[model samples]
Target: MASWRISGSRALLTAGVALTAVFTATLPAQAAHAPGGVDDWGTVVDTKDCVQADAWLVRVKGLGKIIDTKLFQSHYPTTPQAPKQHAGGRELINLAPMGIGLGKVSALYSRAMGHAHPATTSGKGDVPARGEVYADAGGAAVDIGLPYIQNPAGGTQLSPFGVHVEGITVSAYSQPGKPVAFTGGAARGYISVAGTRIIDIPPIWAVNLGVRIPEDYTQAPLALATTNEQVTTDVKGNPTKGPNGAYKYDPKATSGYVNGIHASVLGTDVADVTVVHAAVLRDPKITDKFAVAPRAASDRAGVPARPLSKSCAPFAPPRTAAAGMKDTSSCW
Candidate 1:
C-alpha cells in the first residue's frame, strides 16, 4: 500500500522513498559490469576507497564537463552507520549545486532533493530542500527535481542534468547514523533510471528500476508483479509485510544513504528501489526498455517466474492464481 509521500523526516533515513504518487512510467536498462572492474556491491568500501574510484562517475550531468568525485559524499556522517566514505560517494557523477565547503554533500542534497532553494546560501555549507528528500527544505523529489516535473504553470519540464545510476546491488545494507553495515544479503544488481536527457536535471526520470543479479534468478528484492513496473524484496533478507498481512514491495535500490538515489524519498515506492528502467542485465540486453508486464517471458531463459500478485509470493508451476480469493495455494 504505497502512498504519495509528503513527510521526509519520519521515513527511514536509509534510502527513503514514496515515489508511487507519480503516474505510469517505464525506464531503461544497460550493463552487467561495474566500471574499472569493480566486483559486487560489497567491495571497495572505505572513505578513501570510495573517494578513489566509486566517488566519481565517468558520465556528467552536462555535456563536455567532468563531475568531480566529491559530489556523492554521505551528508549524515553524524548518523551512526554511514561508512567513513562510500562507493562513488553514493551519487552519480553530475554537476549538482552546493555551497563551497559542502562539496559532494552539497550536490548530494541538491540532487536528491532538487534545485538549490531560492533562499539557499551559495557556495556555503547548506542544504536546499524542495519537497524532495528533505521536503521541509522545499524539495519534492519530482515536483521540483528532474527527468520530470509538474510546473506551477501546469506543464511538463525536463531536468537539465543528465543524471545517471550505474546500478544497484545493495539494500538497506546499512542504516545510516548507525555505522557502516551491509544487510548481509545477496540481493545483487538492479538498473534504475541512470541517465537523464538534460543537464542540471535530477535523474528522477519517467521511470526508475532495478533487477537482481541474473546469475541467481530467485534473488532478494524480488519483483512485485510479473511486470517490470515495480521491484520488491521477497523472503531474501527481511520481509516487511503490508497492511494486508503480506510482504510489502520496495524499489530495488543500492544504497541507504540519505542522498543515495533510491533512499532519498519516503514510503513503499522505495519500499525497495524505484525502477528507472527495464533492467534485464543477465544477457541479450533488452532494447533498454522501461517497466513492462510479464517480464519473465522477455527476460533471459531458465529464470523462475516472479510473483504475479500483491501477495509477494512465488507462483506455483504453470504460474496461475487459485480460483478463490483466499487462495494461498501458490508460492507461499
Candidate 2:
C-alpha cells in the first residue's frame, strides 16, 4: 500500500514592465540554441553556442522578469544547494509550495496455498481433505511530489516537480497443484527540478526542468511464499490472508524522494518585485531485497510489458538574471 502528502508556505516577489517587454520580444529569437549548440534540455552539441542557440536559457530569463524578488528574499537560507555566487549574490528563492501524490496497482497471484489433503470416502465415514488456495494478482502504481505556487491574484498554482516513482509488476509461472516460481514486475522513477525556477525571473523564460525514469525494472517480488503454511504466516506478518484463512496473498510497498522549487513574478518595472522560492527536503532508504533488470517488454505472451531503458540526463540550471544582462550588454 502507498499514500501521498503535500504542504508548505507562501509569499510575493518583484519585476517590471520594461524588463518584461524586452524579455518577451527578444527571448524567442535568442532561445533557438545554447552557447555551445546545446539544446534547451542542456545537451551541448557544439562549443561556440550563442544565446540564440539555447532555447531553455531564453525561456528562463523571460520567466525571471515576471517573478517578485521581495517575496523570495524572506525564504532565502544562508546555505542553499544552489550557491549564492551562482545567483549573483542574490538569494535564489523557491516560489512554489510543496505537495505529494501516491497511487498503486496490484493483483492476486495464487488461488490456493501450498498444502496437500486426502480425499474423503463415503463407505463408512471419512471427511475429505481440503487443499489450501491463494489469490494471484499484481499491477503497477506511482507516487510523486506536486509543485504549487501562488499567482498575483491570490490563486494557487500546481505542477508535478521533485521525484516520481513507478511500482513493480508481478507475474506467476506455475500450474494448479504444483509449486511455481513467481517473478514480480519492474519498478522505476527519478528525481528532478522545474526549468522555470532556474531563471532570475520566471515569467520571461519558459524553460522547464525534467528527469527521465531509468528503463531498468525490478523483477523480484517485494515478498514471496513457498507453501500454504508459509504464505499464511512465516515472517513479514500473516500473508495478507482473506476471510477465515480461506485465501492469502503477497504484500508489497514502494517509496522515493523529491527535491526542487517553483518560481512566479508580477509587476511592470525592473525595480519593485517579489519572489518566492520553495525547497523540497527528502530522505529515501531501501529496506528490502529486490532484483533489477533492463526495462524491456518480455516477449512471452500474456506477460506485462515495460519500456526499454535509454540515456536521459537532467538539464543544467539557467544563468542568473544579472548574468543574462551581462551576457547581452545591448539589452541593459
Candidate 3:
C-alpha cells in the first residue's frame, strides 16, 4: 500500500468539513430523476452519468519563487517541483508552479478521498512504493487541486434511498506535493446522488484513473479523464501539442507542463443539491478558508445552502477583462 503520513503536526484546518446536514432521508422526494444511463453497483458508475463538474481554481501563496529562482526547479510527469537538471538520456527539468511552494500533492488526494489525513494504505490491494520518498514544495503550509468514491461492483444498497438524484458530482481540492501547515488549497462540489454514503469520496492513492505509472503516484491528486480529447499546454500555458504525449514530463527533454485533466460537474437542479463537502485542508484556527463550498441545487425551494450565509447577493462575474474573456473567467 503506497502511502505518506504528516508526522510533523501543524494544526492544519480541514476544508469542506461536513457540518452535519439532514441525511438523504430528509430531502424531498419530489422531482423526476434520471441517471442518464449511469450504472451503479456501489463502486463504479457506468458511462453516461450527468454531473455539473465545476471548474475550480488552485490558489497558492509564495508563488514568487518563479520570479526568484530563474531555474524554477520543476519536475512534473509527477514531481510537483525539483531543481532544474539536464543530462543526455537522464535529463529532467520541472516547469512553472515549480517548488511545492503551495503544499503537498497528497492534500489533493486526501480531499477526494473525503478526509484530511493521508491514508497509509492503498484503495484496493495495490502494492506500496517506498514511503520515504517525498515531493518538493517551496514551503507552503498547504495546496490542493481535484474527485471520486469507490463502491462494491454489485449491490443494491443505493436502492434503499428514495431520494436519489440523477448522478453524482465528483470534486477534489488539493495542494502541491508536500504539506506546509500555513499555506492552503481546496476543490469542493456536491454529488446529487453518488456513493454509498454522504461522504461520496474516492481513493486517489492506488486506483488508476488515467495517469501514467511512476508519474501516476499513489499520493498525488488525480481526476477521471471525462474526455479523450487531450489538449497539451506549454510553459507559457499556451497550446503547444495534442493528444497527451508521454507522462513523467521531461522539461529539458520535452514540453514542460504534463497534460492535466481539467474537470467539472454536470446535471440539473444543482442550485441547492445535496453534496459531499470534504476539504482535505483548512486549519480549524484559520476559519477564513479561501475557497467556497460547493453550491447546492437552486431549485431546493426555500432551503438555504448555508444556515445563514447572509442573503443571497447577486453573483456577478468580473466584467473588467477583455470583451469575450468574461465568458471563460471564473465566477469567483
Candidate 4:
C-alpha cells in the first residue's frame, strides 16, 4: 500500500482530537455531505490526490508546530481496490476547532482537503483540493487573541465563528501525455443546515469576523485566502515538453499547494510556531503498486457521461495559456 506518515516526538494535533461537542453526534451521518459531488471512494486513477493545506498562521510560544499537520501535508495516491488500501489518496474528514486555553479559552479551526483523482461516480467526498475557515455561528465562541502579548490588541485578534463562507476548492485530472486539467472557485455564503452540525457555538462576547492585526504589525494579516496552487513535471519528476511543443504538467509529476489556509490569534515574532509548522513535508516520493493509467485524452468519444450529484454541480476543465492546446472535460 502507498502511504506516508509524519513521525516526530513533537505534539502534533489531529482532527480526531479536541472534537468533543454535542454537534459531533450528527457528524457520522453528515460526513457524506461534501461541497461538490466528490466522494471518498470510486475507481480513481492517474490522479495527484496528495496536496492539501488546512491552516497557516503563527501562534505564540511554540504552539504552531502542534496543530494538525496530517491533513495539511501531502499524501501520495494509492488504489482503493488494492489489497492494502490506506488513508492517503482518500478524502479526510473535516477538522474541528482546536482549543487554545490561554487567558481565556480560544478556539482555532482550519478546514482543508488535498487533491485526488476525478470522481468516476457520484457520491460524497472532498472537492479534490479544498480549504475553508469557520467564520459563523457554527464555530467557537471566543476570539483567538495573542495570549503572550501584554496587550491583546497588540497581536492578532480573530474569531473562528464569525462570518459564513462556502470556502475554496481545486480539482484536477490528466493523462500520461496531456496537460493536467484543473478547476475551482471561492464560495462565500452562510452556513447551510447540513454544516451546522459541524459546529454551532454562538459567541459569548462581541466577537468580530476575519483577521485583526494590530497597527504595530507590518504584515497584512488575512482572515482567509483561497488555495489554487499547483506544480507539474514529467514521468521522471523533472520538467518536460508536451506534444504541443510547450511545457506540460503530467499527473505523475504534478504537485499542488494550498497555502494561507490559516487563522491565528498571534503573529510569531519570537517563538518558533511560525518558524517550524507541523504540516511541512520535504522531497517526498510516490509509490502506488496498484496504480492504473488514465484514459487517453483523445478517447473521450466513448467515455460514459456521468450525472451530476444533486448536492454538487459540474465544473469545466482547466484553461492553459499554451497556444494550440485545448483542455476540456466534465468534473464532479
Highest lDDT: give the candidate number: 4
Per-residue lDDT for 111-166 in model 1, tens only?
11111111121222222211111111001121212222223454333322111222
Give a tens-digit lDDT track for model 3, residues 109-131: 11111111122222311111111
How many backbone clashes does every candidate have?
A: 66, 80, 62, 11
lDDT of 4 by residue, 1-332 (tens): 11111122221111111111111111122122222332111112243332222122222233433342221211122122111111111122233324443222112122222222223333422222121100000112222222221234542223322222232222223322223333322232221111121222221111011222221237563222112222343322233347996654344433222111122332332221110011211112332221224533332322222213211113221111011112222121
TM-score: which is higher, 1 or 4?
4
Off by over 4 Å in 1: 1-36, 39-62, 68-72, 75-154, 159-171, 174-332
Rate residue 182 of model 3 by lDDT. 16
* Between candidates 2 and 3, the TM-score winner: 3
The regions of model 3 sitting more than 4 angstroms off are 1-232, 242-262, 269-332
TM for candidate 2 is 0.18
The reply for model 2, stretches above 4 Å from the true place, is 1-132, 135-141, 146-167, 171-181, 191-332
| Every model's TM-score | 0.22, 0.18, 0.19, 0.32
Rank by TM-score, descending?
Answer: 4, 1, 3, 2
Candidate 2: what lDDT?
A: 0.18
TM-score of 1: 0.22
Worst 10 residues of 4 by lDDT: 130-139
Candidate 4: residue 325 Cα off by (Å): 32
- Relative to the true structure, how large is the alpha-carbon lDDT of every model? 0.20, 0.18, 0.18, 0.23
